[model samples]
Target chain A: MEKVLQINNLSKNYGNIRAIEDVSFEVKKGEVYGLLGPNGSGKTTTLAVIMGILNANGGSYEWFEQPFSKLSRRRIGALIETPNFYPYLTLWENLKIVAKIKDADEKDINNALGIANLLKRKHTNFGHLSLGMKQRMSLASVLIGNPEVLVLDEPTNGLDPEGFAEVRNIILSQADAGKTIIIASHILDEVEKVCSHVAILKSGDLIANGRVGELLSAEETVYIQTQKPEDLIKSLKESDLAKEVYSSDDDVAVVLNTDLNSGDLNKFCFEKGFTLTKIQVRKQSLEDQFLQLVK
Target chain B: MKKLFNLEKIKALSYPPFKTLMIIHFLLFFLVILVVSRIHFSIPGFSVKGLYQFPNIWEFFPWVASWFNIFLTIVLITLVGNEFSFKTFRQNVIDGLDRNDLIKGKLILIFTIAVYTFIMVLIAVLIFGLIFGISLLF
Candidate 1:
């Protein structure tokens, strides 16, 4: 896939505080990329630098291989922080203003409202809407005009479960339609659920980044159920795939790297006259990997 | 710039309170003229010497418009402050608006306030001119 966004050696400082230090990463087109980090980990700062909201102390970035420009921004839509709208404006009216600002055709307003599920609430003032509704309305601003890229900061903020599901569905649909997404969120589960790729940030540094599956697969373990659990454990102890092997009840669990072969272990057990009942492969969750990396 | 202007105009019109207030102001200003004009015609031989004769009151339209502009300008300043006073500005950049677009968005907001107020003043001036013109012929 083509690289849609690239950041090289990006760094930013707020007074004496280093917000981001030597961060580099790439987000390919048609993928949901997550910027995962804790608060004060510089997630917001890095985004600000990319969006050109703050001048970076060092490094550079480009979108779609083109140097960042005003025109390029029009192709990107974003929701950062709380959605800003005139409080007295109805949901439809707020979106209409955003549509105009985005240079989208007037007819597209209804479509944007529809996608946000705010079509029925078109005449309700923005201030009076619930928090979740307000968030949807804000997202509607980004979803309008069919921008090529959607950069969302904590997209699910203030959303109830149903609203969150709606936002996730919209994001999935957008990804399916081949639009690029760059999402920054402190919520690990949300990132794990939506991102195809992820970049883990720590104290202004890019700690770990890769395909979500790859990152999550970093810590792999396998469980083997055998009749000769004792002998199976002894033989597996000598193998290099076994980082740590221990037997629990009828199953021998081995925490190992990705290269470990189940066939070799099965053969060894069979040769030793031990009946292997089952072999189960276990992959680490994104949250586990994230916590490990951050640690 | 024109695109920005239109965007600002639409945003300004979107706010119900702002829109409602403008409409209310228009009607009230109209009624003031209507009542005065009716009273002038109702009483036979009533000397209306100081009604429209106060030259200072003619300046009231511009004065009020200027004050409204100042009030909105204060609100604009607050709006600009709010951008930095909160996380939204930073979040916007992370979301890919870039610095140029951020500036453009803010500029559009200011222009909207300016233009919206300008139009309101223009309408008031036109109405006042009409009333004064009609009164002179009577």
Candidate 2:
């Protein structure tokens, strides 16, 4: 697969504060890559640096296998941090500005607005729109040039449930069209649903990176309820069926090995004279994985 | 270059403050020149009419226009300040403009404003100077 973006040991600092340190990752073509982290975890900083808005303190990044340049920027549509349109300009006018910069035809303005569902409000001033509408307008602007790569930071910020779903659909549709996307978001569900690969950042360091399912679902946790929880945990610990067994509030949480499943564990416990009252299998959610990684 | 200019044009022309400040700058320049032309000095040595004729009008019109350059400066400052306050400079780069292109776009805007003021003063100088000079013939 062709490499869309490659960052090698990228570092950035603000005065005395180090924003991101020795962080590195690569995004391949047609992959929806996610950058996930907590607040101030350098998600936005990383995006800003790669987008050429902020200079890195050390290291470098490349786009399309070449040094980042103006032409490379033209091939990527990006919206970082917030929707930064001219508040006074109408939605159509603001998108027109973006279209002009990308050397795109004026017809693209209407196409983008229609996609963002802001065509009815195209002539309305950006400042006058609701916060959710402003965000949608930002999405509209990002679609102006129909670039192959889209870099979006907190793309669903300030959106209602319906609007959030709408933006998610737009992103998924774009991905379906085979456009590679790089999104930096704190919303783990969004990343989980939208990204094929993810890089988890914690306090300016690249802690984890790989396929979302492999990285986040390496172990399946089974919540088992039994009359004798202590004996069940002890028996499971003695057996190789459970990787880690610990007590929850009233249930016992067991992380099973990769090759083991909940049925196998239940069978093992049944043979050991332990009757399971309730057994619920769950894959570790991205949120749970993210919290554990950042913690 | 044309792309940046078109981008800046859409940004500035649609802005109500930009248009309002530019109109005020234009009207104030002509207003000052017209108002100053009507001043009747009691002192015989200094006739206000002399200021509107030929070479004098050339100097007089530009000098009067210079006073309103502060308005132009404010307009320029407002436009540039907007990029920061709105963080649109960062967005513009993300949208495909180079960082240098931001400065270049503003430079083009500055040059365009300079040309507009020049023409306003030039036409004022020509019309006033020719009118006053022709009146002197009568």
Provide backbone clash counts, one per model. Answer: 2, 0
Pairs that clash in candidate 1:
A51-B98, A52-B99
Off by over 4 Å in 1: A222-258, A261-281, B16-138
lDDT of 2 by residue, A32-107 (tens): 9999998899999999999988999999999999999888988899989989989898888888888888889889
C-alpha TM-score for every candidate: 0.72, 0.91
Q: Highest TM-score among the candidates is held by which one?
A: 2
Pairs clashing within candidate 2: none
Please report the candidate that would top lDDT against the real structure.
2
Q: Which numbered prediction scores highest in DockQ against the true structure?
A: 2
Give the per-residue lDDT digits (tens) of candidate 1, residues A1-295. Answer: 7888999999999999999999999988888999999888988788767776778999999988989876777788887656766665577766666665566776777887888888898888877988888788877788778888988888888678898888888888888888999999888888988999889999999998888887766667567897677777888788665776776457787767456566666666677687778888777677756765687
DockQ, cand. 2: 0.82
lDDT of 1 at A216: 66
What is residue A92's positional error in candidate 2, in angstroms? Answer: 1.6
Residue-by-residue lDDT tens digits, candidate 2, B61-106: 8888898898889988999999999999988888877778899999
